[model samples]
Target: LSLSGFINIYLQKTFVSKQLSNLLINGVQPPPLPSKKKVVVDFSSPNIAKEMHVGHLRSTIIGDSMCRLFEFLGYEVLRLNHVGDWGTQFGMLIAHLQDMFPDYLTVSPPIGDLQAFYKFQKIYDCLDIKLIERGESYYQDQMVEVVKEFEKKGLVELDEGRKVVFPPGQPIPLTVVKSDGGYTYDTSDLAAIRQRIFEEKADIIIYVTDSGQSTHFQVVFAAVQLIGWYDPKVIRVEHAGFGVVLGEDK
Candidate 1:
């Protein structure tokens, strides 16, 4: 036999021996090849006081699959459920709670069932998906700082008394703050992205939602790029948007 043929046989035997050793030692489990990068996935963001619909379920499953894949690749994954826990609607709920229980501040009211936020936790547990709850309300205070950052960078423009940020190439500007001084979804998303980048130190950020919100996230991502939050070349930020789930009425 030639020298090249002998070398090929030896290499094939070595590969087979390694596979046999791995099978005996680790069974069906694959060895972990650790990576340094961190990934943050935002998904299953159902609003507080609302039931989990098919859209939320689809996002949850898809996001969990992505997280598993990342983990298998040894990338650090932060699973986030960015629930809609704040806004004008919550303000009305708070007012009603205060009226029902005058000492709401001192004594915890039994508003758990009414809020319906914890109900989703059970579903998540059943799905065996681990996630950290970082709702919009968590960044309510940080939204002010977000607006300040935009203003400091001279990216914000006053459009008829509302604070808006117009991303390059986008015709409509994102309303970060309304004329009534209330923060919109744009403000919360900005704060969340900043936190994930600067605080969470995520090398990659993925937002999983329905296709209907594709433009909204595109605008938010563009605004973040404009604000100099993270270099697009170094950090990967994307929207894993899926098709909308419609009823059979149509």
Candidate 2:
């Protein structure tokens, strides 16, 4: 399209959008002008043992900007880094430590390059099926120990075979243990959500992600609703999704 045509189309679209906004606002019973609102945001949660990539960088920058915007608007903003600090990655890491270098697992940060250690462990396991099984077994045992520790403190419970419990309808679940007696990401996330809400008193949970993740967020919110953690009529989950940041192909 020519420059004049593009400019004309842009103006027309902008005018239409403004008109739609005006119509909607005028048609609805508007809430009182903005007051104190609690906003919680989840971002930059990369999985354990995974390299942080461009996507994570985008989440960090965007989430920080959003939190700043809300803070400037006078809302109580809680920035949450839902770190992938639990589950299966630890399975492999712990297994390799126990099997190969049994002495170093207990050593403080004084001795080994932990990152390099995990890297080598991954390489070794990839080349050995027996090591894979051992890793799986170790993961299961570690999950049990973690669950037991939480259960002792009355923080976690095992249900059915492995389901754990959170408040019903709140998008949380009872992730006791997996069918393989392993701890799943869903289970660990359940713990994290519970801690964030009950311990931290988060009033809202906002997830910022690519628009493609909307379904994932929707299902999670539905689970929370079904599990009884949220009241659809009052509290809710919002996805601040954006389109892909595109550039010309190489």
Candidate 3:
């Protein structure tokens, strides 16, 4: 045989040997699977009044695929679209809309033009100073009442200007109220988490948000622990970490 022919034959023999070894191992029993149970797979829930951009599209695609896979594997899947429906941003969106049409934000569509609404809110926030002031005031008043009640009960406190929630060192004091007395992210998140657990009865609450927000999620999960919502062993809260997409390099 030619030199090249001999080399090819030798390579093929080595490949076959490796394949046989792999096949023999494959005959062993696979590891036991986890106990069958229902699962809640949350993903792609864009803020209610925000645009469904390319990133959101990717979330929907991946989340739905996961839902399907879990369903096929005999897990009862509950799909959650935890929309960002409430916040300071909404105050502007609602206020600017109230100024423009006087009746814009009345209709809370189940799933409607969120991206456009967010865009409109941004435009109003930038162009109109008076409207921004009004928006900030609106959200502030709403937060004060809740924080005062919590403070009176001694469930929360102000530390270093911001509302710090000291829940036995599991997590930092939650900032339900900001330094300016505005409702921070924690309040809305806690309300949403409570609703999901009690109303939706979510077995697994997976937050499919940006990885940079992992610390925020850890704090939220710790707060959940403080609130005594679920047994840490049974109920699962996870931040499904993922990276941002970048342009392909040549």
Candidate 4:
């Protein structure tokens, strides 16, 4: 087609899209998904109490765009902010919280005020971001089961006293559980994937992190695949990784 003709057609399509964008549904019928689709987007998981830097900003912007696009397409999107609220660091945080709020140690201590404080620490009063804060600690029990099942199935092998799974083609073998029987990030990540698949019924689970975690997610997704938790034909798991930030001077 000629350049002018093509431009005219594209303009018409764009105009139509803008017109129908607000009409999510004519009546009770809703927009269509490509297929049986539930998406779980894991993103912007800054460690608790840590400062938000360039890395966090990049992740948030990229992930939010992805979520917005998927939601607009009528996909059931689970926006999972995989916050670092688990493991020993949390023990330290809890100790500090207890020290500051001594009543935390007391029997039938006050929690209402603290809870309210957490809930209201927002950017603005009138703005609604619809943020639901759920800690990774909430999934501790589920992670235990996930690791135990791997142990039971012999899917993991011990490497120098640490339970690990060396998925083929990956240099970094995933640590299923520590020598002390504590779960590692590998165990927790796989467990979260299982939760998204079975409980949330997510057909596509995406991890949006820096390229550093690309291999990590590969192994986690592979572990789930090996465990028969998901099939590539039926479900999809992806790692949408981004590059590192460097000073312009460098």
| Candidate 1 overall lDDT versus native | 0.87
lDDT, residue 250, model 1: 44
| Regions more than 4 Å wrong, model 4 | 1-36, 95-129, 247-250
| Candidate 4 local lDDT, 117-235, one digit each (tens) | 34332521333223345567767899888878887878878788898987677677888778887878887787778778888998888888999888788888777878788999988
Better of 2 and 4 by lDDT: 4
Candidate with top TM-score is 1
Off by over 4 Å in 2: 1-33, 105-176, 194-199, 211-213, 242-250
Worst lDDT run of 10 residues, candidate 4, spans 121-130
lDDT by residue for model 3 over 31-124, one digit each (tens)?
4448665666666665555554566555555666777766676676777655555666678777866676654468644434445455533532
Structural similarity to truth (TM-score) of each candidate: 0.82, 0.55, 0.60, 0.74
* lDDT of the candidates, in the order given: 0.87, 0.58, 0.63, 0.75
Better of 1 and 4 by TM-score: 1
Better of 3 and 4 by lDDT: 4
> Which clashing pairs does model 4 show?
none
Residue pairs with colliding backbones in model 3 are: 47-84, 48-84, 51-115, 165-173, 165-174
Q: In angstroms, what RMSD does candidate 3 have relative to the true structure?
A: 11.6
Task: Name the 10 consecutive residues with the lowest summed lDDT in model 2.
Answer: 129-138
TM-score of 3: 0.60
Residue 95 alpha-carbon offset, candidate 3, angstroms = 2.7
